[model samples]
Target: MPRRQHITVFAILALFAFIGTSFVLMFRSQPQGADYPGPTSQEPVLVDNEILLGTATAPKLENETLKAELGNAAWKVLHTTMAKFPDKPTEEDSQALKSYIHLFARLYPCGECARHFQQILAKFPPQVATRSTAAAWACHVHNEVNKSLKKDLFDCSKIGDFYDCGCADDGPVKGKEKEKEKDGFKQLELEKEG
Candidate 1:
């Protein structure tokens, strides 16, 4: 194979390995709450009126259209991340996820939205022990936001179907493989025609 082809194959193999490792980590059951530091255990968040007033250090993005777009995209990322969380995560993984969530709320672009998210986090706290719990928690929190916004609530039971990341046991590229094979056949036909 050409150098480029070799590199592509290697990259695909590496991706498969990483995904496989994630699956293994997710399935390996750890004791419930063995390593998770719940909100009560974590350092207290100082109540800042600036954050509540939408005037914190994070820039206030007030564009309504942009805010909606950002909110939708952020929700997608959150749901997918929770969906992929390990079934039995290590203490480190659990802590990292919880930390990431708090930071994500703090750093969200729209100051108003961030404040709302902070309140939500304060109320819900992240459920990071198992993948199912994490995903369900995400869905519940999302519904809470939707309820506040007067938006239609999503079916939490169908969350797995909605946020399917294609990280199935079979592989991520089954459909891609078929498409690539078809494209290769088309390229061969074109070459013959030429």
Candidate 2:
């Protein structure tokens, strides 16, 4: 065979070898955590209403990356919410945003991540006084999570540059949540219509 053909074949073999090894390591017999299910079930155990898998949902966990992907998506939602917060929120608005974050931490599907988030929230409570302050607070909290994970910290100064909720004039993100935000305010879209 030509040199190029030989190299291609070797690469294919190496890829297969790597995949096989991964499966073996992943499925190998090892003691499960105290919370892990008994041998009869592959499903994860629930602790205090939190699903303790690497990830979870109404749908099944697809892979190891699902947790990180969900985290990314959740962060996008949060950052955008902060961006669209009212410039001078009323007392109700402030309470609503504060309640939302606490509920988010309590109800997040990932047990481990949710617990950590709850702790973080306790340490650094939500700051929802105004749009800039809210957004800045979100950025700071994200950086805190990053620091704990040993991930590179995000640049808080450029958070607005990073997230685009697609709201016009820095408006609220469109969603079911907007129809009835925590304080039961009128829908943002309807307000725009008036």
Candidate 3:
């Protein structure tokens, strides 16, 4: 009887060990965050000094032709907002941008529109890029949106894809616009981290 008891105890211990090992292996194999290609090294990418200017300028999206030409569904949201705001810029416009950003940051949140805005901001002058209170507000929005969207969601993978930068088509070119794109990408990455 004693030998039988010892064997039973050993079997239980082995079972527990097998379960724990399996759990550890599964956790380690999972991918972290969005699949966007991040900087390989620990060193931070240098921000464009020229793009660090005061306030980001409001992008021109008013012309009917430009509005009609926008290809992305997300750009349409921005265009609709521009159409509603027209000539007079308000605190609401800034708030709207912020709200969109926050929503885009969420795992399953709609990111198409917010990504488009980031691309547009990448074209602004440094002073305008850094100083725009509106842009700062939008960043806050992006953060908030992410938080709100993750509350009830189970699958984080879907959300990551929705917000991932690799999904965006905007690429950096070899000129001033490229500099702006870099800054914009950095800003989005920072926002995601926060």
Best TM-score among the predictions, by candidate number: 1
Q: By TM-score, is 2 or 3 better? A: 2
Q: After superposition, how far is residue 8 of candidate 3 from its true place, in Å?
A: 0.6
Clashing pairs in 2: none
Q: Regarding TM-score, does 1 or 3 come out ahead? A: 1
Q: What is the C-alpha lDDT profile of model 3 across 85-187, one tens digit per residue?
A: 3123455544444444333322112234334434443442111122122333333443443354463332322222233333133453567865664555344
Candidate 1 residue pairs in clash (backbone atoms < 3 Å):
26-87
Give the candidates in order of lDDT, highest first.
Answer: 1, 2, 3
Overall lDDT per candidate, in order of appearance: 0.73, 0.69, 0.41
lDDT of 2 at 68: 89
Assess candidate 2 and give its lDDT: 0.69
Model 2 per-residue lDDT at 5: 100
Off by over 4 Å in 2: 1-63, 165-194
